[model samples]
Target chain A: MPKPNNQDANSLLVLGGTSAVALAYARLRASEGKPIILVGRNSDKLKLNQADLAARTKKPVDIHVCDLSDTAILDKNWNAVTSMGHNISEVFLAYGLLGDQLKTQKDSQKFLASLNTNFVSAAMWAEKAFDHFAYKGSGQITVIGSVAGDRGRQSNYHYGTAKGALEIFCDGMAHRAARFKGAKINILLVKPGFIDTPMTDHLDKGGLLWASPEKIAKITLKAVFRGKRKIYAPWFWRFILLLIRMTPRFAFHKTGL
Target chain B: MKPVLSWGRINDKYCNVVRADYFADPNLLTIAESSDNGMLLAHGMGRSYGDSGLNKGGVIFQTTRQNHILDFDTQTGIIKARAGITLEEILRVSVPQGWFLPVTPGTKYVTLGGAVANDVHGKNHHKVGSLGAHIMRLSLTRSDRKTVICSPRTQKKLFNMTIGGLGLTGFINWVEFKLKPIESSYLETENIPYTSLDEFFSLSEESAKWPYTVAWIDCFAPKSKQGRGIFTRAKFSNYGALDIHRDDHIATWPFVTPALFLNRFSITAFNFLYRWRPGARMKGRSHYDSFFYPLDGINHWNRLYGKAGFFQHQSLIPLERSKEGIGDLLDIIKESKQGSFLAVLKLHGPEYSPGTMSFCRPGKGVSLALDFANKGQKTRQLLERLDACVLKHNGRTYPAKDGRMSAQTFQTAFPQWTKLEAMRDPKFSSSFWRRVSQTTS
Candidate 1:
């Protein structure tokens, strides 16, 4: 899908909106007093985010908790979100898991859980959102992919593989949307490098490279509104990823990356 | 990613900063259990002049995102707002409604929580007291994850402790304060010249009936002209029209001015021209902006002091001994040749504040707020000398403006320190508390 030009479209539907990046994006939109429908499974986090957004924004924020890993639940949530009447100018997809890499490598259940959350659930949301938004013909879908997916990191390869699959699924969605007339479905694949969030709490973070969720959200919002089809958050990540993608396999193995 | 500094642009520190959108639980992050300075301090607009607001290598809970004016009553002049709401915000909403804050500090860039935490006093402090005087209620969350609502009447002791508690008591969620009704946002102000400290005292005494009064001293003046400066007296003009001019802030000091640019020569030159500024003796009709927050015109004006940072020393001496105490203090300043251009002297009424450790006592306050480029040993020695003179006269310095005051100074000033220590949250502590309290043992 080509970049859509209509950024002033009234509403936003954010899945996994409780994530720090997603919450910051929602806040930017809410500060403009715009309507937002937040979807996630954790009611506690949703409630917390809801209180925060409500206090900051003039509009009444609506939160719906649906476990995205469950396909039936995703369908029900899709219907519920569409019915809320935001016109859902943009559907922000932020659901995924960075499950413990060592645990996942040893435990099949852990690996499956990560894969189901990072790939299968995203695919389900994309299919449901694309079908509905395509019929409507004017909306955007933003999925947060990661730099880890560019070339699997040894420490986080499981999560990376799932994200790699999700990226291909989104590419197919973008291609299929071209066949439908009047459907200006802009699909944005946002790839962010190391971000400081609750997910990265275990890592000792402090540096020029680790972008705060606020910084990533600002970059993501700028890209989405400008209708960029793809973006490496912080913009500099584009160069970092290019260098990584160009590394020859023999040399890359020698580097122990 | 860089270290955050306070308004004074001194004592910069790095911390795991978190945004408390609305109300994020303080305990969510696995912060160290009181390691060195492990306590999480709520940072608002970074307005404090010293380490009172800094958490060295600890967590800082940023409350700027939680700014929301939840409720306002026009007739009763009551407003309920989140702690993160700034005075500039309150003025934006309340000014045009013929209302204003009961008390305001020198700048409006500070948050309501910070103002309440410091219990800041304005020129009208003689009449209205500190910001805490107008606060009707507050919602505070404890380190143990319990939320409590307190006012002067309910949870009386806790309410008083949290007022000027410097954020050690809990996370202030929201505050309710009674806005003083104003005729208009314009003030009919008068500026007069005073030649001596005795003359200032007389002028301050005579102007007690005026709603607001404050005097700026020319610290650069020779001993022959010592205590000579301007006294600005004002009261809201009785126009009864709620129409106030609002202009978008367009110009700001984009970057920090180099330290060398603010030497004794430059500060003295500015003070000389400022004292004799055009219409210094005229009766002027001024907006609340110039009358209350003249420094707010320059964004990060504190940066003008350079990277070393400056200290703002505000000491209160009992009314009876004020002349001798302030005289000794000024003589010490003159002898040392370390003078601040922004020295202010005011008289606080005898109405005792209920905030146990609130700095505003019934006395005469002489504030020496100068930017000394933090030349470590010499600067510390100069401030210590000033502390000695203040202590000799039984004067006490304000904790909010304090950076390096010895524990002896704090203990002597507020003998009630033991009371505050008893109520201090075990999970909460600060760099200032540790530094000053350590001197005891």
Candidate 2:
């Protein structure tokens, strides 16, 4: 989403370049013949994505290295991307840590590290993009939250807490965008449920409810183009999450979702 | 964990499925070395009809996520890509650029690695041979955690063994291959109706001048016109738009049709109407997707065979004896009253694949592919009898489409299996290999 005057600004900036969902989304947009910029922690993995995108679309693809845990270099990395001379009209925030909930329950260090990666670092990066978009007076930022953030569960409460925090940040950003006069900036919250990505490789994904990253990515790009504030990927997840949120405390404990 | 079955859905292997990614920290080989799941195998798209991609009670590395096109040269028509990328994905990028796969299987869902592993052949086998013939290089990682970049010029023997190696040699990291240049995405095709086995053979010979030729035989035709079919020949049209196909209206088979739905009566009727359909005897222009992959229009078409699934038997017979061999095979099938909805017949040229264990012979041959709905013991018996006929004709059954060819038949037909076994990675094994080699471990 860019201002009516900046329609020529077409470059897409993807923060989690190595992520399957992010890469899929980039591919869908790459066909439009627009430049793409990727930022991630792993240089080798990012290089592969760069090669794939560039070779397939015959479009310019650039990558920047930025480890989310290393907060000191966040500003420097953001600056490097913004100064690359491309009109980056949109930002896709897709990086997050799905840490082991059982291990985090016992190890305080691991718990905090998961929080730092999923929330503290993710929110900081999203905020930087928000500020830039606001300054430009028109842009869209899509943050990938999880359906698990709808409510805290015993299985992954820590991970849920981090995503839940991100959801709130997105909500506040939406409010801020509306209040800023003459600005058309928008924030889209994407809550994907049971996505069959490498991140969830350990889970049994044989159920019909599980969706491919490509399907989720397709839905996400369409939502961003339509200026949607928030959407649950695959559409069914919205009703499922609503039911989970409405459950009574006693019944919820018995079910143990 | 969910059960992992090959396309046939006949062989169900209890595997600890592990998703492999290019960005994985330890990498695929290291992950295999550390796993205690006894043996390992890499499954790409699971498009192989049988157990060739399965590792029973072992660790199966699902490489679908490893898909990525690394490089493409529009001028030279050469492309390099990771093994996990599917043919459909590659075509989506390359077709509009006026390049096409030199040889492609009937379905574009097969992965690059699986194509090399099976050395799949296409209708153009008469002109370009198989996919292995066009491959320039491969990146293979053996069980010792050592990755080797092999080509026909360097490490030639490993390269040969790796092709059609059934993922037993090692994990295929990526592949680089040559592509055929095309002027358009459409083909000027001619369809001719012929009756009798002799007419089919004569039509095949006459159509040899054409770049691509195949026939669809009605196995259930009346006794007098037993081997009658529609012969088709095509060449890439010189002038047309190079438009990449879009899969907007692909219909998925909602669920497994009941096994009863594919019985003799239904299949026979379908085959009857299929051969005499309005467009069955016309010359026309067709998109590459329709000409190459008609079944792909319906996603999950395998479900049509029912919960038991179906088995594909593709036999390659020498040109000298193909007429008699194929006739005998079809006669046996007809006598068994098992109707094959899809009965394809194609001719292979003198060109052979570079693989030592390649199924297609160096000399000219005729291949017949038939699909049989799984009928439990009855179907198993029919397939074994077909294998016996193939052995008598000095032909071989394709491993990629075989579920139950006896060890004797396999070892006899492919005596070079020992060479591949010698170079096989110690940690990699597949259900097909164990069954055909009769090796417990």
Candidate 3:
């Protein structure tokens, strides 16, 4: 397969279009003349965001409805779309749900469902995207990881564990894809601290470095364009998390994270 | 290769925040040419009262790790070193050898790069301009990763950009500046008390003729005595006639105070006693370290602010708006019932660098610094109000000290913000800029 020229590679496929961070990323890319294809479960929200993005960019955007929680449905729709000439040069896998740990612990079904949505679904999408890019021989995949994955805390270890798996998985995928000749698949894993997003709207503000969605998206896009392997959103979180990880175990357990 | 580093966690009582980050030891490779693909922001002793040294997630070319003295020309008083070198380090080696940084901030722990970033003004700003004026040349790594040598005559844009660019234009790896030769570590210091704002200005104007002058204003003073404060002036002692000894035992404060200790009442009392203290006249041999970073005596002084860190709101108003601007600002603080004990006033001269967003300009700028207890939303609202006033007077807020000012105010304060944005590297960013500027629609 021949590499797509910049003009021919102007389409974006955002896996989690309903995400404000993902939407912001889409908006930024759209501003740079790339049309976006928003993929998510919420048809109404996706349509609303599509309209908002079109109004912002003054360009038409496409929308697709697919609930990633149902792996079968997601794969079916993904296969059908790829078959229909959707040559997406960029695949943003930003879908994830922060399931209530207490509820998940009480119900095994809930825990399994959360795990499938957060980790399993991400891996499936990554594998599919990698295969697609290998066939086309060029593309970028960006995954929104969490700083909680750096070190698990009592507060949200379940979510952290899921994110941790995704991070390691992406790291391995990046390493493996680099060996394939003529195939260019750059992976960006974003480890963000507390972000003022709908997913974290109920939680109390965390720290001085907690970033806004728009800020995270701007940094994320910048990193994607630069082909960064990994980035800590709101840069201070890098130092902050580094300190948290390096804290001596004897003192770490005593000092509340 | 993995980076070797040392780390320290200090909770500031003044700002009431905990700062835990890696500090590059004096022996580490502080600035590797390989890392120059991204820009580096030199962090001195982390005492700009704000974000000048913070590079967010990007690499902050830690200068403290490479504070070795490269060379010192004793005869002409020319000094060159890696930009990470601190005023305290220079004073440590030179005070005994009879030399000093041509300019020093209130704190000696400040890195040479920070002084240039803030273009720090001291008691003698009126006479010396700023630290940038004394800087002869700098070796910087631009965004393109080229190690370019810049001086006033060569690469003048990069030179000015590095000076006050807030570490945005590039990383300053090494700098060469003119140093003032000193005879002794002691200063001939005197404190003159002023009962009113007019008197403070008169004394500041009069004392400028001398080599050094700084005023400590009492914010709690009544309307009639609004600027009533203590004025301290100093000049290098004629050590040629006195016996001088170099001792490694630098005088420093040793303990951190409780956060609640720096409240309005405590600071007000401290200011009153400081202004009217009996030991107003003193002539003793003091190390350059003690003379500059008096606060350095107490480690983790910022911890005094408790768990909710504080914000230092420092602004520069045109000399014409000094009296009205400062007076109105103080009145607002008083009305808000917010207590500020630490307020220092100084007269600024002309700005030499053309850093697109340089905070200093031509005028007698008065900086009003206050520690607002990080009371969450309340504190943020207050800062927004203060930012409004700063904008009203055509003044700008320091990005280093600001964690909450909006992009609109930033645009207003820095009319050249769009131009700088155009120049920003897509790959480079910081938490400070990310939070305040990147979020704006």
Best by DockQ: 2
- Order of models, best DockQ first: 2, 1, 3
For each candidate, give the TM-score of chain B.
Answer: 0.94, 0.97, 0.83
lDDT digits (tens) for residues B1-441 of candidate 1: 237777666677776576665435456225535334557778898888788887776777778756666666778888888898789867866776678988989888889998888888888878877888888999987766578889999988989998888888878889998999898888999999989888888998889899999888887677777788898899998884665434334457767667677667877888888888896786979888888988887766776676677888888777777888877778877777666878888877754456877887544454444445565687788889888877787778888888889988788778887887888766566667777776575
Candidate topping TM-score: 2
Q: Which scores better on DockQ, 2 or 3?
A: 2
Please give, for residues B305-346, the per-residue lDDT of candidate 3 as tens digits: 555557778788888888788788777776665666667777
What candidate 3 gets wrong by more than 4 Å, as runs, is A1-257, B1-44, B55-58, B240-262, B280-287, B353-356, B439-441
lDDT of 1 at B147: 83
Error of 2 at B309 (Å): 2.4
Q: Write the per-residue lDDT of candidate 1 for residues A1-257, one digit (tens) a residue.
A: 23322234467788897787888788777656667788988887787677656544545578888787876566677777677645567789887888898899899988888888999888888888888787777778999999888997687889999988888988898888777788898889999999977787667777889997778888888898898888888889989989988998877777756
How accurate locally is residue B63 in candidate 2, as Cα lDDT from 0 to 100? Answer: 82
For candidate 2, write residues A186-254 as lDDT tens digits.
899999999888788777667779998999999998898899999999899999999999998899999
Clash number by candidate, in order: 0, 0, 21
Off by over 4 Å in 1: A1-9, A164-183, B1-115, B122-128, B139-147, B170-218, B224-262, B269-309, B317-328, B341-353, B363-368, B391-394, B426-428, B434-441
